[model samples]
Each structure stands twice: as structure tokens, then as C-alpha cells.
Target: MDRARKDMIVKEILYWKDNRMLPEHYCDYLLALYTEGNRPKDKARKAKGFYFLNIILLLLIPLSLLFIYFTELSFILQMGLLIFFTITGVSLAIYFTNKGIAPQLPLAVSALILLLISVEMASHFFPHHNTALYGALMLNCLLWIAAAWKFRQHYFGISGLVGLIIIVISIFI
Candidate 1:
């Protein structure tokens, strides 16, 4: 590819990642066959779960903003969140490269938690912005349900219940 075309492709990939793109067969591949090198290692170990969870968080970008909207968080708390996400994101990326992600990846788990909390806050506190609110609610709900069904209780089944509640309320609201 020409220099310009190559640059465009690189930019597209970056955009897709920023948007948290998930593959269709991502869940399906969890069980079909095991890749020998896919397991986690140690301090150098990389958890695949954390890796993919980070991707899913891309979709949560809007929802995270919703969190900032409703919650009466202190400036420190907000800054803390920013730092925590950045650190965890970078750590998980390293793990992804090292194949240290043995079983459950921490990033995926964190995303599920973040999604649930954000959805709940949006549902309970934010009373307006039907479009943005509903979109976050529905998206989080579906993702939660899918994650629960695929990973089972291992990924925190509580999120499934939360998603169900959000979906019902979304329908009514």
C-alpha cells in the first residue's frame, strides 16, 4: 500500500480500537479450541480476559460520562478514576502481548462492573436525555447479558440481573 493508504488503514484500526470493536465469534471461540500460547503467565503474564474487556469498555465511553454527570464525585475521585483506568488499560495491554491471561481477564471483569454501576446511576439519577440514556442502557444490558450467558457466573452473573432490570425500565421509560 502507498504511504497515504497505509496511514489511513492504521488510523482506521486505531479508530476501531478507540470505539471498542468486538469480533462476532469472540464468544464462540472461547470454547471451540484452545491455543497453547493463550494462557497467562506471571508479572509478565497477560490476561486475555482483561484484554478483551478493555475493548468492550470502548463502548462504555459514553456511559462513563453518564457516571460523571449524575454522581457527586469529588475532584480527587474523578482524577483517581482517570488514573486507574489508564494504568489498568496499559497493564492489560502488556498482558495481552505476553499471553499471561490464563482464565478470567481482569479488564473484562472491570468493564462489567463499570457498565453495571454506570447503567444503574444513569437509570436512577439522570431523568432526561432519552436518546443517550436509553442507548447506554440498552447497549450495556445486551452486553451484560451476552457476557453472562457466555462466561456464566464466572464473569459475575449479577450483571445479568442488572441488565434485565435496566432493559425493562428502558422499555417503560
Candidate 2:
């Protein structure tokens, strides 16, 4: 196309991006193609990070199904597996963030769930230590808040805020 048409297309893509009609990454790719000068930002890093993440996800799906079906495992064993998964997920999420890829939401969510599960297990195992349980939960919430602030993760911030509110309300009651 001619210069004017190409410019018009670029403007349209920008409009879509600003209005959230198109994904920001998609818009960036189109813009790069049209402009034929500037490169798309973090393209290689995102691609590599997501490629490995997708492979891991594909493998995890069936493994997770099997895990869910296996209810006969001992509680300690289950908790151990969950802790491993949580650590792995958090590490991958950190790697993605450091590499400028969008950190995988599922991984973060899984890590949070596993953490809560492990805490619940600990509370059960130490039945006489309600105060310790509360302390641990509160510490987890505060750490989430600090991490959210440091990483600018709105979901973490929101979850941490809700958890803090719940902890405070529980203390009053």
C-alpha cells in the first residue's frame, strides 16, 4: 500500500490498542510490520518464555487430572507434592517477570492455593496452635501485599487486601 494508507492502518491499530479492542502484543506486531523500522518489544523473550510455559502446561494437564483422581495418597505426601508444585510455579512466574513476559496467572494462582493448603495442613497437624496458625496466615498475607507492591501485580494486591481484611475481621470476632 501507499504511505497514506499504511499510516492510516497504523492509526487504526493504535486506536484498537488504546480502546483495548485488540491485544497490546498483537497491535505492537502489526505496528512493527507497518512501520517497517522499529522492532516489536521483547518479542523473542516473550516467545521463548511462553513456548516453554505452554509445553509445561500441556504436560501438567493430564498429570493434574491423575493427581486429582488419586485420593488414596497420604495427607503428608499430598502436602509435599503441593509444596513442590507451589515452589516450581512461583519460580517460573518470577522467571517470566524478570524476562519481561507476562507472568502466568495460572501458575501464580496454583502457588497461592498450594500455600493455603500447606498452611491448612500445618494448622491441622498442630491442632493446639491456633495463634501460630493466625500468625502464619497474617504473615503470608503481608508478604503477598509487599510482593504485589514490588511487582505492581494488581491481582496479588487485591488478594492480599482481601486476606488482610478477613484476618482483621476474624480477630474482632
Question: What is the C-alpha lDDT profile of model 2 across 1-173, one tens digit per residue?
Answer: 89899979988997787567988899888998998956346457647867877577545544544554567777677667666666666777776666466775645555465546647666768878877777778777877777678877777778878988998899889
Which candidate achieves the best TM-score against the true structure?
2
What tens-digit string does per-residue lDDT give for candidate 1 at 1-173?
36566455544544443344644254224312232224232333233545556566564555456545667886457546744654564465455545434324444545554565555556556667566566776676666567567646344457656766866776787
Off by over 4 Å in 1: 1-105, 112-127, 146-158
| Worst-scoring 10-residue span by lDDT in model 2 | 60-69
Please give the RMSD of candidate 2 to the true structure. Answer: 9.9
Give each model a TM-score. 0.34, 0.55
Model 1 lDDT, residue 143, Cα:
65
Candidate 2: stretches off by over 4 Å = 1-70, 104-107
* lDDT (CA) per prediction: 0.53, 0.70
Deviation in Å, model 1, residue 99 alpha carbon: 4.4
